[model samples]
Target: MDVLYFAWVRERIGLPKEKVESQAATVNDLVAELSAREDRYAAAFADLSALRVALDQELSDFDASLAGVREVAFFPPMTGG
Candidate 1:
């Protein structure tokens, strides 16, 4: 799956996108896997509450299944003025 990080998450993880090989079933499971990889990943995924996830460009919950999903994006909730 191609994982994309935006805004502060991109800053924390260093790169904006990467193709990740994961056995994770759900978004939360992926988060746990990433968080275990390094300090940067841990920091980027520190607080799930402050972040939002999108599966193939559609907003989704963290517990959502990743099956058949090609793209997973991690970013803070958007705000508009």
Candidate 2:
């Protein structure tokens, strides 16, 4: 799976995207795995409530299923100007 980081997430993780071989079946599981990897991922995912996620390019929730998914992106919730 390709995990993507946006804005401050990219800053925290030090990358915009990366390919991951994960056994995680859900978004939360993936997050847990990523967060456990290092401090960078932990910080990036610190406040899950403040984030918005996209699965396979479709906006979704943190608890969404990852079945047959090829991409997962994390970013802060967008605000209208």
**TM-scores for every predicted model:** 0.96, 0.94
| lDDT of every predicted structure (CA atoms) | 0.97, 0.92
lDDT of 1 by residue, 1-81 (tens): 999999999999999999999989999999999999999999989899999999999999999999999999999999869
Q: Which 10-residue span in candidate 1 carries the lowest summed lDDT?
A: 41-50
Best by lDDT: 1
Shift of residue 4 alpha carbon in model 2, Å: 0.7
Model 1: residues >4 Å from true position, as ranges?
none
Candidate 2 lDDT over residue span 1-81, tens digit each: 999999888899999999999989899999999999999999989999988999988899888889999999999887779
Poorly placed runs, candidate 2 (over 4 Å): none
Lowest lDDT 10-residue stretch of candidate 2: 71-80
Backbone clash count for every predicted candidate, in the order shown? 0, 0
